[model samples]
Target: MDVTVVGAGPVGLVLAAELALSGAAVQVLERRADPDEAMKAQSINVPTAEALDRRGLLPAAEQVQRELLERVGSFAGAADDRPPGAGRPAPERRFTGHFAGMVLSPDLVDWSDPDLAAHAAVDGARMVPQPQLEALLADHIARLGVPVRRGVEVTALEDTGDGVRVDTTAGTVRTGWLVGCDGGHSTVRRLAGIDFPGTDPELTGYQAVVDIADPEKLAGGWTWSTRGAYRYGPQPGRVATLEFDGPPAGLPHARLRSRGGTPMAPVTLEEVQTSLRRISGADVTLTALRAAPTRWTDNTRQAAAYRSGRVLLAGDAAHVHPPFGGQGLNLGVGDAMNLGWKLGAVVAGWAPEGLLDTYDAERRPLGAWVLDWTRAQIGVLRGDAKSAALREVVADLLSTRDGTTYAVKKISGVTQRIDLPGDHPLVGRFVPDVWLRDGSRLVDHGHDGGFLLLDRTPDGAFARLAAAWAGRVSSVSDDHATPTGVLVRPDGVVAWASDTTDIAAITGLEAALHRWTGAQTSSPAHEPVS
Candidate 1:
């Protein structure tokens, strides 16, 4: 096999699909016998939504989001009976999500900001639940003829220079590459001897749906206390709480979910009710517990490195942080999208020496950023006097136009830019969703999972230049397109761009194709685009 992907979660499935799209032989192995239907992520960031659109899964995601918005169930901050997106202003003017527990105001965001507006497209973010997204990807994988072997756990890995030997519960398999998309307690990462070190937990959090004898006794939405934070319903029987006292003395880690996994220990009526009373000081009583209660902590950590020879890590295996702002699922999805095509290039034998290493270089810093993002929220939610004061400051900042726009930009991931070598302003940034002259959009060509060149020159000079890297890139052109050329990577990042398709600009395009696609060319110099 070309690649053996561990863990059948969204990240693994996405990576597998992208590999298949890139013509790489890939298979997935998951430990769980069945899919986990627990309450996990409730939304996909803008880039994640665009990623789905790239794979033609956007329609299904939209359908699922409509269904999820119909009923606000266990998920906190879920939309009410109004509908998924009914009567909202322009997508840019809306409040992103929350910062800590404080909700951002829609009117406070500066919709006029060019940086934020540059990334918005016809499709904003979507509210598709994690389980729905997995089902969607599962169907996509079936169409692609990729096998996702569930109930098979990774026990060990042996790197034999050219390939990896993966020992699983069912049997052993050898592949040119092995990727761990497994959750936080990743066995592949553990067996690879990769260092996962970071800050410890400061509080224990709980989420569950139960029959409360007196539902009105507890406050609605997110309520905070000096002890910690708790959320008690926009929906009946839904309750979540966190305590600064940390997990119970010795309760086997009291974990119920790992970014995307099944429950570990059922939150009993006694355990949940006591936790509620301790934090809420309410005389609330629980009669029955519905679904398994989930416990998570701010136990943050990241892998020392993303790659160890032929063995690699992505998603939760690469990093773990508090599920604040629903960043975990989006972060993992971004990992799959970023690593999929790059790794495919490696397995296809056309990859440059340091191509695969770019995955580690580009994604690790984003993982670090997400960890601190969650840490910032925890700092505001610490529930101490210090926390209260900090909350006031952040809340004040969130009320301003620039502050709200910045938060929205960060949360939506619309303006995410990687540090790459290029002089063009758009280089290293996620390509803006520009409209093509043929009445199609740049995203229309993204579904093929190949490099894209959007060139607009009467003589089609740039398209001819990109033709040198045939099979690896496809070009789109028409007279109606603007007088600019853009080279987009498979992950939707702008690799190169030029304002004029002159002789000098053609030389630059040829060099970019060589640098990014590893295709040898005779182009000697690259002139920076003005």
Candidate 2:
């Protein structure tokens, strides 16, 4: 096979689909026999929504969002407004997520900011939990004819120069490339000897669905207390708490088994009850456990290198951080989006030299930034008086137009820039959904998952120039876009852009094309591996 993706979660599945879309023979191996029903991320960020939209999968995901809204109603209104069992009836305003434990108000955000304005094309967050998102992606890959094998664990990995040998519980797979999308305790990462280095944990967190004996006593939404922090219903029976005692099981992140599920062994009801009582200081009791509880920590870590020889890592295997801002899921999704097409290009034999290396160079910095972002929240969230004062100052700042805009920009990732070579401001940023003269938006043409050359010039010289890389890129004329012409990679990043088609600009476009698309080949330089 061209690529063997470990961990059949959202990241692996997305990478597999992109690989298959780029004409690579790919397969997925997951350790779980079935999808975990635990409530994971409640929403997806800007780039993730656009990634789904470009793949023609956003409608399906929006349907999932709609179904979710129909079930729970819109997540609107303030936490204190609802008494226990107060029936959260809302078509009210949306919440913009939280910093530390402080809830962000959508109204406070600066919608007029260019970053948020452009991101409005994709609009606000989509409320779909982790399991539903995974299901949606799994179905997409299924339609793409990618095989996903569950109950298969990666036991070992050997990168023998030419390819990778992956040993799994189910069997062995030999492929040109291997990606570890497995969770925090990734076997593939371990076997590959990739060093996962980062800060240690300072807090232990818990999320569970349970029957509370005194539900009315607990507060709604996220709450920071003198003890620690706790979040109660927007959903009945949903409970989460953080205690700054130490890491759950008092172990490092590497020693932990997975994202959740009571950590290594099953946590008892007594443990949760004790935690809730301590954190809330209200004597609230969890009467019955409805589902398996999961333990998390502020244990942040990232793989020292994304690629080591023929083996690569993505998603949780590549990095781990506190689940602040719901960034963990979106960060993993971004990794898949950024890495997928590049890896696929290499496997399809049209990628220029050092193209694969760019994955680590680009994503590792972003991963580090995310870790710090989460850590910043941790800094505001300790039970000490100083942290409380810090949280107040941060919250006050977040209430401002500029502060909220900056936060929104970081959270949405709409106008995020990579360090690509170019002087054009649009270069290294995600191309906006520009309209084409053909009456279709940019996303309409991206369904094929190839690079796009948007030439708005009257004579379409750039389009003609782009035709040389026909098999790898599609040239379209757009009358509405700002840039005279723009080259977008399969992942939607702008590789080249020009406002004036001067000789120098045109020459630069050609260089960008050659660097990204590899030699103007009429067809894939190599056939798909079986």
User: Could you give candidate 2's per-residue lDDT for residues 313-432 as a string of tens digits?
Assistant: 898889989887678888898899989999988888777537889999988888998999999999889888888899889989998868876776787777678999999988998887
Q: Which portions of model 2 miss their true places by more than 4 Å?
A: 74-95, 250-263, 267-269, 287-292, 437-439, 522-530
> Could you tell me the TM-score of candidate 2?
0.91
lDDT of 2 at 436: 65
TM-scores vs. true structure, each candidate: 0.91, 0.91
* Regions more than 4 Å wrong, model 1: 73-95, 122-125, 211-213, 233-237, 251-263, 287-291, 480-483, 520-530
lDDT of every predicted structure (CA atoms):
0.79, 0.79
